[model samples]
Target: MRLPRQREAEVTPLHADAVRALIDAAAPRFRALYLLAASSGLRQGELFGLEVDCVDFLRREVTVRQQLIAPDDGEPYLGEPKTHESYRTVPLTKAVVDALAAHLEQFPADGVKIEDRTDPRKLHHRTARLLFLNQRREVGRRGAWSQVWGRSRRIANKALAATYDKAHAAWVRNGRTEGREPARVEVPDGASLHGMRHFYASLLIKHRENVKTVQKRLGHAKPSITLDTYTHLWPDEEDTTRAAVEAVLGDVPPLCPAKSA
Candidate 1:
């Protein structure tokens, strides 16, 4: 049986400059959210479900223990990750550590109550030291974070637009305005909070990390899944291959080193 083609995941990974712009535009409470996404490649739910205990600054790692599931009928609650592999830990960069630390300083953990899904009545209350909280001061919900993300994204996009306008003005002065206007490359389209994971994958591939390494970090069930998701992000191999071969072969000694005279 044939399955219908799935729509491609719209991905527009933010570059360093665009990311920095978003960071500059974001408030202190939300700064860490963006940084952790880019640095760790965690899913939105995993980030939302984080407890105060999940972060280990000393270890510079975050444990993906569970997720906060939002349902239509009842209040959101804690649940296991999408897969068993999704329960793995992810290492953090220095930037992510700093962001998280600062965010904690400003916004201390709150004792928000979420139901225990394992319970039959769904009446069990567990105290969650949620990272981001909603306007009701509860753990941040999907809509709340989505709103914040959208605002920051808009600010960054506007900055990109201003930059393009400035460039176009200069181009016109130089008598080169007849062609296509400068591109708004920094402006990403429809890339939501989840897109940060894609950006993180690109970063790993850009630094020449291996597929298996990315798989482990991303908590993919298998290597093929990692490849299927991010094969395009891997750098061109021809140049690196040539350089690798030449580095070793070029310095190799002749079949026999010349005998001393």
Candidate 2:
């Protein structure tokens, strides 16, 4: 008997405006984290695993040296990135660099002793100056991070809803009630922290960045994987074909025009 094929994962990236709102609404300590995630496309684990040394302010880049791995029965620890390609350097936009700088100024980095398991053969212990830490000033765990993200999402949604309410009121005051009431504004349902990574990929595609470049920036194992996931976001082939033909041959009159009624 043949097994059924699995459905592809849905890709619903946040719009630019929504990203801005979320970043603005995020808690001060985590605001830069959100911006970096959206800008760099680093996986959640990679973001958590960042150390002070991983970010180069002068070069405006963040190197992916390790990731935070949380096992079923133990605490989270530093480990190697998911794949060889994941160990790459991602460039940062000026805005992201500024935000990171401000974050560091507000909340200074602190050294923490954590287990390093980047190599499976040998586990090492080291004191790392982590870029981000939990409220307790220790290494952040997945569960705590998720909770904070959820709280931030809720705050953002409420702020968006309030803005919509204000706009609707203005529309009513302007005597423009010709149609049904506009629905409340909220971030897409089921939009999680991972959506920021998707947003980053969408931004790269929008800027006409080539597939190979996108793959490298996102640390995808292969170009095919990037294509498989983001093929739809690219310019439509049919539209490109028409544009190419139009460029070669100026607008041609229809071969057979319908007779005037």
Over 1-261, each residue of candidate 1 has an lDDT whose tens digit, in order, gives 999989576344777667767776676677788788878999988888888799999999999888888876667988878877888889898888878888888888857878755334554777888887765677666676778888888898788778888988987887985677676656376768777788888899899999999998888889999987888778676658778788889888669777899
The TM-score that candidate 1 achieves is 0.79
- Give a tens-digit lDDT track for model 2, residues 1-261: 998988697576787767878898888888999999999999988998998889999999999989988776788799999989999999999999999889888888867888999988999888877878887878777677778888887888888888888878888987886576656756776787788999999999988999999999999999999998898898764457767888888677768977899
TM-score of each: 0.79, 0.85
lDDT of 2: 0.87
Backbone clashes (count) for model 2: 0
> Stretches of candidate 2 above 4 Å error?
1-4, 177-184, 237-261
The per-residue C-alpha lDDT of model 1 at residue 172 equals 83
Please list the residue runs of candidate 1 whose C-alpha ends up more than 4 Å from where it truly belongs after superposition. Answer: 1-12, 118-123, 167-183, 239-261
